[model samples]
Target: MEWIIGIGVCAVLVVIFTIVTYNKLVSLKNRFQNAFAQIDVQLTRRYDLIPNLVETAKAYMTHERETLEAVIAARNQASSGLRKAAADPGNPEAMKALAVAEQGLGGMLGRFMALSESYPQLQASENMKQLSEELSSTENRVAFARQAYNDAVMTYNVKREQFPANIVASQFRFTAAALLEIEDQAKRQVPKVSFS
Candidate 1:
């Protein structure tokens, strides 16, 4: 009868809907992983450049040896952070440590540049200029990558927390991912830089 056919159609539609929802969840999960991978790529580049930047500064400004050492130490700490993050990307502590290390490294870089400013010849050196430019580019890339990763995390987290999606996410063990947090309270406050 017509009632039997209607029932069959409803059941088929439900099955199709479930399959589509499951596939969408899988796609979102993959996007989250891809975003994290992008961040990892940029961080690796930044780490590789840190040593060269420190060495270049050391050669130009011998008196800034302490600053260079600090940078190196921060780099080591950050490297450890990267390892921890890689081992467990969901670990919030690793993210915090990495953020602190990054801030420390940034402060050391500022000091290195300030110290370099004292030496006009060093500033004008071809090698120094190239290194400075490279570091600046790396910083920009890091910022871009961070933004991309955060955006992806936001998308995934939202999807996983939604009503029906939450059910699917829980079944798949898709937990929320942590963002790279700013650890230093002082650094949390934004400083205004005036061009005037």
Candidate 2:
């Protein structure tokens, strides 16, 4: 009789452990999803701002059609890539494509602003100034979003690998998320800013 009672208690303990572990995994997964959603919101805000900036720059820089078009194309590609990444957050290829598209957009945006230097009148224009400010603000927001997403991924991944959590994670297929990479090689090579 005592042997049967012992077996029954062990079974109940195993069930309780499994339930707790499963709930923790689910909570971590939801946190990761919430992080990705935050990034998407910032990216959408940036996409909306890009066209206004291109139009403003276009007015003073009539000869910059190629640059403007490249910006537009890159923006479209990035938007699509972001959508794809959101659907499959575990795919590294989608993340890489999104990063590349964003870099292309950044390059075109830099060219647009550099050309703006040629026309001081345009640079001084109220519309251009406002658009420039808006772009800067959006960039800051995107950086914050990336940081937030990384933080959430880090937390989730830590939970997935530790001790008993590892047993649960392996059984349920909880994979770690990829971190966002910084884009510009030129910025890393040298002091990109020149006061002269």
lDDT per residue (tens digit) for residues 1-196 in model 1: 9999999999998778667767887777677667767777877887888788777667678877787788788778877887777666545687777778777777776777787799787888887888788888987887887777677777877888898878777877877877775444555788989999
Worst 10 residues of 1 by lDDT: 178-187
* Superposed Cα deviation of residue 114, candidate 2 (Å): 2.0
Candidate 2 on 1-196: residue-level lDDT in tens?
Answer: 9999999999998889878988998887787778878888888888888888888878787887887888888889889989988887645786687788888878877777787799888898898899889889888988898888778778888888999889888988887777666487657677558789
lDDT at 132 for candidate 1?
Answer: 85
Cand. 2 TM to true fold: 0.89
lDDT of each: 0.76, 0.82
Residue 99's lDDT within candidate 2 is 82
Candidate 1 off by > 4 Å: 1-15, 182-196
Q: Who wins the lDDT comparison?
A: 2
